[model samples]
Target: MKNDSYPTSTIANNTKRILVLFAHPVPQQSEVNIFLFEDAQLLPNVTAVDVYAEYPDFNINVIKEQERLVNHDVIIFQYPLYWYSTPSILKEYQDLVLEYGFAYGKGGTALKDKLFFCAISAGGKEEAYQTDGFNHFTIRQLLQPLEQMASITNMTYLAPFALFGSRSASREDRISTHREKWTTLLNALATEHIDLDRAKNIENLADLTINGANE
Candidate 1:
């Protein structure tokens, strides 16, 4: 059953609509993203779509999904990082919904002028994502493919909103931090306060923490 609480036309009015495509295999087992999504859902002009729950059979409604994309000004992909990438369903959704003639290639102007961002939860510590760290690569490098995808689709790619140390973060801390960040991101998007130029220059959302503080 699709959640139509926030219709597409309603999204085009008053505020810039932010469609959050949330993908998690087991939401009950999630600690960070769940709270973040819950908090984000409460904000006006923000709509949360549980991809896994909505399309468990992988039978995605491409037209409907594309319609949702065209109606919103910003698209936020929310998920738990799996092996340094997004969950399986998200990839599937991208492949199916963001088709060649629709999101890219000739006549693919549906997503043009739109914005794309990510909100992800990682199981590793921040240090581990560094060049000399265990993971041996920055999160920015790991997420380059999505940036390229956004570029190909003519969408403005913004810095992601990431929560590291998910595996070790205390339940209380996880909830608190994710909620705060979710609220902050929503407010920035709602009020057009985000620094798009800075967001495009940075590799990862974490990098924005250092840059945003200076601004």
Candidate 2:
């Protein structure tokens, strides 16, 4: 995986170590996520990993992945939402790296108290993911499995930060706005400026705004 880390001296004091596990099967076709991923790489106290690029053979190193998790205070799963779930490689990564003894079930507390969340881009519009809409479920409802995974692993699960209408986001200013929000959120998360309680209660963090008031 591509690991991006800032020098120890350059990192802000008391900032959280953020680990972004980015997964995109075909990044060239992406209109927005690739830019967000690139922005994440430029931030201090953040480690961005392109999982697809690193584990093309599906041969993930379990020990190293566990170590990465242990070292970071925040974990972000960044990807394009596929069939209301994560990409196959990420699922595979979980299966291989989050072993019974390492993540849960009897003395497993490697990820305890850490924050976990996803950054997803959806092809459908926000309205289409409602009870009466085509998807017949909210984005939060569709992501229960991951939430439960975080719970079982002893990590605090936050609402996902999602971009809807992603297919057409590039046509207007939506893509640019979304990228700006992503950067702002990342910075807030790194500096512990984000309110965790509010984060968990929100449906999504796409429109999240952090200010001195919240801090």
Candidate 3:
């Protein structure tokens, strides 16, 4: 695969750890997300978890989840955009794991200063999520609640990395390229090569121009 314009390994380190909370109810049927998760899992300092598979009963293990969060510097909530929000289990994970005096409230310093972001796959085209489009709002506008969640927890919120039109027919090369970029970003993130502020301000981390955002 071509490296394209971005330097996949321009920098390197495993100091910052990453946790990918992949919440797909029917992961077996996934075409893109599953591949991204598996590739990310093979990288150094990255942990990918299938949330549904781990807690099928919706009975979350709060302590264990919290422990997982504590070990990672970056926490990624990866899921397909369902009704402009996350899957039900992610909400459940938050409700159960982010307890008082832990994720938010007095002494809620566990996730403070950590990095938090989302990776979403949308069935609609990118233009459909704009002011004049059928959806009538940008992706960022729809993610305000998540941004607030990061604010409350004192975590840095980076704009999401999204793949739109997932339900549409796709060319093999295009899919291959997007898959490569997924691993590239994961590698950059593990090495602390991304400019946090740049990532936060960018409209779309998946934009091809994101090469400029990497440090």
Top candidate by TM-score: 2
User: What TM-score would each prediction reach against the true structure?
Assistant: 0.87, 0.92, 0.89
Candidate 2 lDDT tens digits, 48-132: 9999999999999987898888888899999999989998999999999887767887667778888999999999999998999
* Candidate order, lDDT descending: 2, 3, 1
Index of the highest-lDDT prediction: 2
| Whole-model lDDT, model 3 | 0.82
lDDT per residue, candidate 3, 77-187, as tens digits? 999899999999999999998987777786677787888999988988889999999899999999999999999999999999888888762553456677777777876
What's the count of clashing pairs in each model shown? 0, 0, 0
Candidate-wise lDDT, in order: 0.79, 0.87, 0.82
TM-score of 3: 0.89
